[model samples]
Target chain A: MTDTILSHDDLTARVSRIFQRAGLSPLQSDAVARTIAAGERDACKSHGIYRIDGCLRTIKAGMVTLDAVPELAPEDGAIVRVAAHGGFSNAAFELGAPELARRAKELGMAALVINDCTHFAALWPEIEALTAHDLAAMAMCPSYSSVAPTGGNEALMGTNPFAFGWPRENTDPYVFDFATSVAARGEIELHRRAGTPLPEGWAVDADGNPTSDPEAALNGAMLPFGGHKGSAIATMIELLAGVMIGDLNSREALDRLGNFTLLPAHGELILAFDPARFSAGREGNAMARAETLFDAITGQGARLPSQRRFAARKRAMAHGITLSAEEIAHLDRLEERGLDAVA
Target chain B: MTDTILSHDDLTARVSRIFQRAGLSPLQSDAVARTIAAGERDACKSHGIYRIDGCLRTIKAGMVTLDAVPELAPEDGAIVRVAAHGGFSNAAFELGAPELARRAKELGMAALVINDCTHFAALWPEIEALTAHDLAAMAMCPSYSSVAPTGGNEALMGTNPFAFGWPRENTDPYVFDFATSVAARGEIELHRRAGTPLPEGWAVDADGNPTSDPEAALNGAMLPFGGHKGSAIATMIELLAGVMIGDLNSREALDRLGNFTLLPAHGELILAFDPARFSAGREGNAMARAETLFDAITGQGARLPSQRRFAARKRAMAHGITLSAEEIAHLDRLEERGLDAVA
Candidate 1:
């Protein structure tokens, strides 16, 4: 059940070719391809090339327009709205991040809300773009229904993922990204594929009982991270990402299965602020101080959030990404078909 | 061990007189008193008038200056860094909230960081103040160490409470305030005083073993809400309130606990934003939309966050606050001692 990794260049080329065959303009295809490649580079495998099949499915369904560009509404001074008009979330973010970063630099802090975009992959790329530009950034998305309210048996909340990045003086920006649930549904999917048991307190069976069986958990509801507190935090995020953006909640979108044509209308909110505006040399100092305190508390034993992903990415970059035989076979099939479409 | 509640006016006047007798200026005393009374009005008993004795203790120890006013440091766009110089948090927020709210009106957002203030009672009033001005507000405070990090036995983090408020069209502003821990230390104290057992999983004994005894829990560590997820959220707030503001984390401040001459360098961060800048009628619409979705979910037998506090505040406002006989005796003793000090 192990997944195979593809070479970064090979993956990027295939992604670009797939988008081009789907009728995407050259620039649009390049942007989408780079976004997917960046996900692989960051080791966000769930959101990387794994999503290519889904994106292709969406394009074939006519749910996403390969040539459509986001429409910016009239706004002023540190705020912007993008009506994605059934475009790819990756495409919308690629088009919006730089402009949002530029506006934040000019205005001190800026917020961008994107609506009607189809599936978005990993959120870290947008945060990375902002952090690279020396800005502190945060982004949130209301995902499809999967998690349950704190005490309830039924699934009524999306995983509701959030990502925040802070600029560091010498090192990579401190980035934190997580779902409100105890574990993401993708992890559950991984466990199911591997025939592994789910962890206790992570999910409940359909009859509202906790279970260690991955299949039962998958057919049931995922638990929020920290009981009622996590529930409250998830609720706050939902209000911020769904209600504030005038989109549908997870419960309302439960009927939308894997079909991209029935994708739920969730919203994304992004905020970027310049650390220099608030503190002169404080950004770096703050990160150093944080690292010191974190180390003290962790004391050679603490694991900072996202440390593993970054480490994996570093290793993979040094030695090209390795793919298993099965994964390579799958990619070869896709490549053959892609070439046929191009012909 | 029951507590008493006084009429809002009576408590405000008595608290004001106590501050004046402690050498506070009349205006500052009134402002501080009102802030404290607001906590009682909102049923945050631990952070309400219960802290008057502690405030007096700090003042008598010469740790808090009765008449110190904060001065703004040079900065850009609606951010004020207040050098508290050992002032009370209530006083700092009373002075900073209005100023920040006024600036947010002009700039669409503003923040205030208070550096060296003494303990501030409930954060609701300050958040409510911004909502009163038709702005969204958030407040956070990093206190001295009191709770253990998730999976750790040491108390390495503060309860690190946060509060947020949003102004609605036809209803009271929706306010959400809670400590990040599984249960606040105050709840443990309440249970200990009442000789009651705590619920399981709420706390741990000194050895990090789960304990249901309130006294043992008090001597041990309170659990972070939602395991690692709650831990991550608390860590983020600690960075925001502590490192970002140039202050010490709770674990760092433990050494100076009984040093009367030194002020605890915990920090507070307050942010105010005007939703109108993002969308026309967004202020009211945001709140209304949140209420609608919240009602829809909760109507089918789900409870909303802070509903109990909202109900309690309403009941107390309508039927008048009642104090228990023991609480009245304590209040009388406090007043008598204050009169003796003045004499």
Candidate 2:
């Protein structure tokens, strides 16, 4: 069942060709391909090539414009709003991250709200770019709603993932990314498709009753991770990601044929704050202080967060990225169909 | 046997006298008394008179300076550091919140870090004060080591608490405050003293075995809520509240004399940001927008976080702050003991 390894460059080239054949402009195609490849290289398979099929389906459905690009809108202070014009999230993020970080370095902090961008893959890359600029960054995205409020039956909220990155001295940046749900919707979906039972407390049946049946859980709603506290954090994120950005909620977005056309696309809120701005020319010393504290905590043998994935990325890059047999077959099919359409 | 109820005024007067007798200046004693009473009024009994005995013990142990006051040191870009000189947190916060808010309004955001302060009762009052000035505020406090890191047997992290407040248009500001632990240390202590069992998964015994025995749980370590995710968030908060503020880590502080002076001291980080600073000068409309969003979310029937406590405070104030019979007896004991010898 295991698949053959694909060199990173080889995979990226193939993905780029597939996007170009699907009618994306070269720049947009390369951005999307690079993003997916980054996810694969970083071991985020769920957001990597696994999403290519969905993106193709959405493009065929005329929900996303293969060649669309976002343009900036007028904003006050360090806030910038981008009109995605139905573009892909990868392209939008490729454009937004550096812009936001640049402004943040000048203004201390900058907030960029991307409106109407289609599904973007892993969020870590965007945060990584900000951290590379020596800025602390936080990003949130409101996807299609699948989670229910604690004690409620209906799916009134999205899994609403949040990611944060902080720079450290002589160490990998501290990066943390997680969905506010008890378990990711993808995990539940995978279990359901495989006809397996879910762990208790991860989800409930459509009637709001706790159920181990993966099918029932998928058809119902996911629970917040830690009862009220998790629910509260999710709620706040929803406000920041959906309401503040003026995007449609999951239910509303789904009602619009699963295409988000709301003003200020429903994708991500990226914020960056330059530590140098706050450190008053002592950036090096401040970073060292952060590293010393981190070492002190982990010196006792506890692993730091995200360190494993970082190590995985380094190891995979050194060796090669592996793909499941099914994933490889899926990509081959996509390549053939895309070539046929272009021919 | 339950003790008699004491009037709010009577309890305040007694606490004030005790603090004064302990060598706190009159103004300092009054500030401490008011903070404790505010906690009682808000029904945070564990942080109110419940801590009076501990405060007395710590004072008698000569670990705190009754007459000490905070000395402020301003940093670049709206950051301020307060050297507490080992003073009570109540007094320190009373002197710090206003200064922090003023500077934040001036600079769009301000961060105040207080080191070497005594334990403050409750965080809600400080959040409320900031929200009243139309500022969104967040506070973090890292206390003594009481919780274990995820998968660790030894207690190495504090229950480090975080509180956030957001201002709405017409309705009261929304506030959230919670300890990072599954339950606060005080709750575990109370359960142990009462010979009660804890809820399952709330804590682990000394050997890192999950246990329901409160005594074992206390001797062991409290679990983070929601497993690894909660633990991760707690770890992040510790970095922000401890490392970023240049304060002590819980374990390091404890090692000093069971005093754990890892950082310069146990520290609290207070951040305030004015919404008006970002809303592009349309003050009234921005407020309206925030309120509309709050109403929309609450209208969905999910209870807003911290709304109940706020309602309780209103009711308590209307009918006069209530004291349990036992609390009344404790106040009487304090009055009879006289402040000097108690200290």
Query: DockQ of every model listed?
Result: 0.35, 0.26
Give a tens-digit lDDT track for model 2, residues B186-208. Answer: 78878889888899878988888
lDDT of 1 at A195: 93
Clashing pairs in 2: A115-A264, A115-A265, A116-A265, B3-B325, B247-B263, B248-B263, B253-B259, B253-B260, B253-B261, B254-B260
| lDDT score, candidate 1, position B256 | 57
Q: Between which residue pairs do clashes occur in model 1?
A: A226-B226, B4-B323
Native-referenced DockQ of model 1? 0.35
Quote model 2's TM-score for chain B. 0.89
**Candidate 1 per-residue lDDT over residues A1-343, each given as its tens digit:** 5767667787788778777876766666776788877777777777776766766665665666667787776655456677777676666776777788877776567777787777556677788889899887878877777787766666778888878877766666677888888998878888999999988889988776888888898888898887766776677667666666665556544554452224455568887876565444343466677777676556524356676677877877887676667766756665567533221
TM-score of each: 0.87, 0.87
lDDT of 2 by residue, A56-107 (tens): 6666666777778777765444666666768887777777777777767765
How well does candidate 2 score on lDDT at residue B2?
Answer: 52
lDDT of 1 by residue, B1-343 (tens): 6766667788789778878877876766787788767667767677676767766665666666778776555555556666665666666776677777776777666778777677656777777778888887778877767777766666777888878777767667767777888887778888999999998778888887889999888788887777665666677777777776676666656555653223354668887777665445333466666677666556545566666666767877876566678666756676667634321
